[model samples]
Target: MSDPSAAGPTIDPMDTSAGNRFAPYSPENHSAPLWIVSILGLIYTIGVLSIRLFIKRRVFGWDDSLIVAGTLTGLVQAIVFFKALKSGLGQVPEHVPNLSTTASLAFTAQILLLIALYLAKCSGILLLRRLFVRDQQNTGRLCDVVLGFTVVCGIATVVMSSAGCPSTGSFTTHCSSTNTRWSVVTALDIATEVILLLLPAYLVWQLQMKTSYKLRVIAAFCFRILVIIFSIFHLIARIKYADTQPSPFNIVTTLVWHQTLLAWGLISATIPNLKAFLQSLSASWGGADWGYTVKAYGNGTFEMKSMGTQSRSHAMASTTGTENATDMDQKYETQIQTRQVGERSSLGSGGSQDMIIRKETVWTVVRS
Candidate 1:
């Protein structure tokens, strides 16, 4: 793969003399990777934005902010890799215009990739923390421990990758050693993902919800399992190219996987915040109030409740103190149970003693 002659007319292997061997630069080779990154970035941005718009109270939380930072770093990494490809990164060494410059750009790109991955992992963990760490549940302790472990692993992988090779010369001379270091980093990446996958499963398993609801929530969180699968694919690709010298194709494949990892991670983190949005969409299409309402109490607390619409109508009709009203209330009482309970503090500065009742009805039909 290092033979420039094998690359055809674009690269001239015969002119191996120092500084005269680089082929004419072309921008086309980078188009695929750039497009992949762009599409993934767009999808991730939409997911995060949807979270803010749909979940109202969850706008730009710690996890969302971290993901935004990660996305920016990922964009930088993609740009650097694109430039490196134009410098002949995947082609034969002699095809590169400036070997030193390519090496430096590759090094920078590698570091940025690591930083983006770290931020992505942390973002997912923070999201899990928000989802599962509320109240006095001891489950929060597990999330804390997993978060600490993820931080340690991310830092360790970055430090090892940076320090494993002192210079570009050493990197070329010790391809096997570099491969070994990357293997460790890949292992750490998979480990962190596994921890994240399990955290949500554990939380959902302990919830006292219906089996169907548990399964639905678990399915949403389980989307990150795709990230784990992608990580394994990346590791396999890295091993396959380990002996071939870092070429443009190898770097492109890595970038593709990296972008995929970022997209899936952001999507998984945003799933929990999408319930209200999905419910609203369903209600709009079905043309019925979905028995969901947002209400504010006098004590500066807000609650969202889901009740049966049919039961609500019957209760309204039976408002008068009559025997039929009493019977209807009892018959429909089972349908008014709370589906999900969330609390938020009011943004106003009114005294706690002030009695205020505010209600906002969000329409949607309840599906049994």
Candidate 2:
């Protein structure tokens, strides 16, 4: 039933070995390396999920898109990881079934998934623009342009990848005809990666954060830029060895490095958003319960140090104390009563006052 022409080379015809191939695709030769990488990926994914679930809120905003992107990418890596295990270590019969189709499809999906990861990188930065940019119109227009570019790159990658195959048959021998197109896609991919990495650095440099905060933000973005360097290495490897016989070891090594960077990129991009989400959540619950109070009397107006607004019109008036020593005792008592009442009202009504307020003179921090 077997076609003589369709069978690939024997692993060792003279020895008549049961499972080993004499000459095989590179990845099929070794299982240990792939398994190791797979385990590491699993461990990393677990850590990522934990942080995503349990982390407390911080000062920055979290982008859900980045979260989805990270989750999807981890899943994709896991799929490829299992495939690598099979291809590298699984037994091969004298006439093993050709997996060119399955393998090719898996690799294709991996590439596409990576591109999606990169696009998510770009999208995350665009979201940051919305948060940090004071100019509404500029942010909106920049988002439109960046989004359109992302779409074009994605379409190009999919089309070129599918078209690279010579035929639909999985068993076909020359399925690598589209290598040229892949090269083109890789170049475009690298360009977009560079642009995405640079944009964040530019934005961070221009932000009006404190010197210390600015440095911290810049360092975060810099780590992402280093991920792009890994991509550059991948691109170089791809170009250097694309036409050579499939070296599973070399390819897997390259893929592992690339995936590692991608994992870090997710973490890096999520940091700011994570900070924001926690801060917002903290402010929403029990944060407004805290307050600042100032007790004073006379012609002089009492200012609330904690209140950000220019006037205390929104603040309830405490017992009036003015120009009289005897009134001080009564006035202080009234102040305490009024303060307690306002705090109770605020809690009962569910209002948000800035969680941390700095006072400028006259205003006393009655409660913080």
Candidate 3:
């Protein structure tokens, strides 16, 4: 559907509100940044779907939930962003578009969509926590806290988005600049973004695995942190513009860019997990059973076992023609026992040292 905001009257450039919050009502004000947000949103949506369908396993998992949420919000945001872009970029009409009705409905719809996006983001985080984190703490307790907080934030955002705007279906005024919703939403956003970043670090640290595996887990956490940083910057830009009247540029940056970052982070965070999901499918294709091996010689070797095997016979030189069968058997037994004892002692020492080093590395990374 076309944006309800597009049907408004074209406001001529003149002495007006400093920020011009209602300038978006005119079709002449949308600009490049808004369009860029729309484009990024579209890209994110397409990439998410393509990865989920073709690249990653479509199984029910944290990665799958995240991809779905990202794609859904990304697509919705693209639609709204496009509408915002078109409303601004279109040719100015001889008479102003009657934006009163449009703005009223658009404002209401925007509020609902914003709430939905918030929920989606929270759900994605919860899914990740479930899949990646294995702690001694009760999972249900963590989930309850997250869900309760998310619900509060979602309600707050919805209320604030509509608080200063005209009542539903009324076109008299567009959203107001003094509405506390803008600042409230921004604050909630920053808080949630920080929570998302910090929890993953804790989750990675608590994972029970080898040191190398733990590092991989931490890398995943770092990826999430980077996205949170991007989102924080996005929120900061919006918070700065919250009270300003919406210029074409400011509106695009405030509303559209913020949505894009939220969606983009959701998509980007799932990419690694999606990749892992895809790689797991390779196991079903009869690939070799591959793993690392430590030998008695203090060297680590990577190896794979396939389906074939062979046998070999060893010939021992006879020392005398009078050797009895019992004597020969005793000699073979002694040789086998000696070899086994030497191999076991070396392997035991090496294994113990490796375990110690692994524990030390794990503690260092996790504590940091």
Candidate 4:
């Protein structure tokens, strides 16, 4: 259903006799990776968002809202990808339902994918701002610059891609200038990933946290490196495997790699911010009962010192493996304790009374 004047000549999808021919071997299905990665990533993203909203314990913000939108867009993008696969992607063109249809669907998916990725990155940046750049003026300003730059690059890609190709024409074949545009977009994408990676690594060291604790936090944000890798691979696939015309074999691998990146991108964005909720999962980050000693100390309350006093007194204390909760707060003390989805108590006690101490609290959530 392409505008033949703009897209040029086309053939029926099922008319393999008129379709482009590929390798002689039997075609393999690449949709498995696409399906696995897209579905699972969406499930994880939605599951965490549900906890943030319905459970109502976790603080919600702009980042969470962005993730919700991104997830919806991603779902639509995935469906388009599947439709492309059904049309002819990753198979012998002759065997597919329609090469022209596949091309159109893929173009649509490409647009949606860009939107999904843009939203996810924005969400991550917002979360990063809240975590490290909230109070620091310079760092916060730099974070704003990054966010603005991302917005520009996203718009640039959308404009270039929208003008580059249509449903029926061959892209990356005769469109050398369009390829150059994509090269620019790809470079910006990689730079964005690198910046994201460095943000946490650079800023975590600036915190009053101990070196070891800072490294752990940096490690939690390491998925950005993989995102960079996927970005490069996605560019390569787009530039290398394509034909002068639409072909299923060439597009399938690109789809697979793109899905891989998106899945990991979700992980990269969510894991760092979800640390609080993650620690409570009992399955994440060295689960409970790792031979750590605890005395069960918590007042489970946030209260003020007095009606006339302008100061607040905290009642919860954080303990390491064996550190006592009664001690005053230390500058570099790492909080090592179990956390759960609904704020489950780390220590179970029947006869002992609840002890109250003040512990620093950070309200954070996940996004993808």
Candidate 3 least-lDDT 10 residues = 359-368
Segments in model 2 whose C-alpha atoms lie over 4 Å from true places: 1-28, 56-62, 87-96, 166-182, 247-250, 273-368
TM-score of each predicted structure versus truth: 0.66, 0.58, 0.57, 0.66
Q: Pick the candidate with the highest lDDT.
A: 4
lDDT of 4: 0.61
Per-residue lDDT over 18-108 for candidate 2, one digit per residue giving the tens place of the 0 to 100 score: 5554333332343344456556755775565455444422212234445566567666766765664454422232233445543554465
C-alpha lDDT (0 to 100) for residue 108 of candidate 1 = 80
Q: What is the C-alpha lDDT profile of model 3 across 1-368, one tens digit per residue?
A: 99878999665554233344533333344454455655776677577666645542323454355457646755665565455444432223222254443343335435545654665556556655544433336654675577678668878877776665665322332355533555677677667666766665565566455556555544544554554555556566656655554333344455555556555555655544443344445533122111111223233332222212211012122334553443333322111111111111222343322111111111111100
| Candidate 1: Cα lDDT at 214 | 56
lDDT of model 1 at residue 359? Answer: 21
Give the per-residue Cα lDDT of candidate 3 at 88.
34
lDDT of each: 0.60, 0.48, 0.47, 0.61
Worst 10 residues of 4 by lDDT: 304-313
- Model 1's alpha-carbon lDDT is 0.60
Worst 10 residues of 2 by lDDT: 334-343
The Cα error of candidate 2 at residue 16, in Å, is: 16
Clashing pairs in 4: 13-97, 13-98, 16-94, 280-339, 280-340, 315-357, 316-357, 316-358, 316-359
* Cα lDDT of model 1 by residue, 216-236, tens digit: 656666777887888778777
Cα deviation in Å at residue 341, candidate 3? 33
Tell me the deviation in Å of residue 203 in model 3: 2.4
Ranking by TM-score: 1, 4, 2, 3
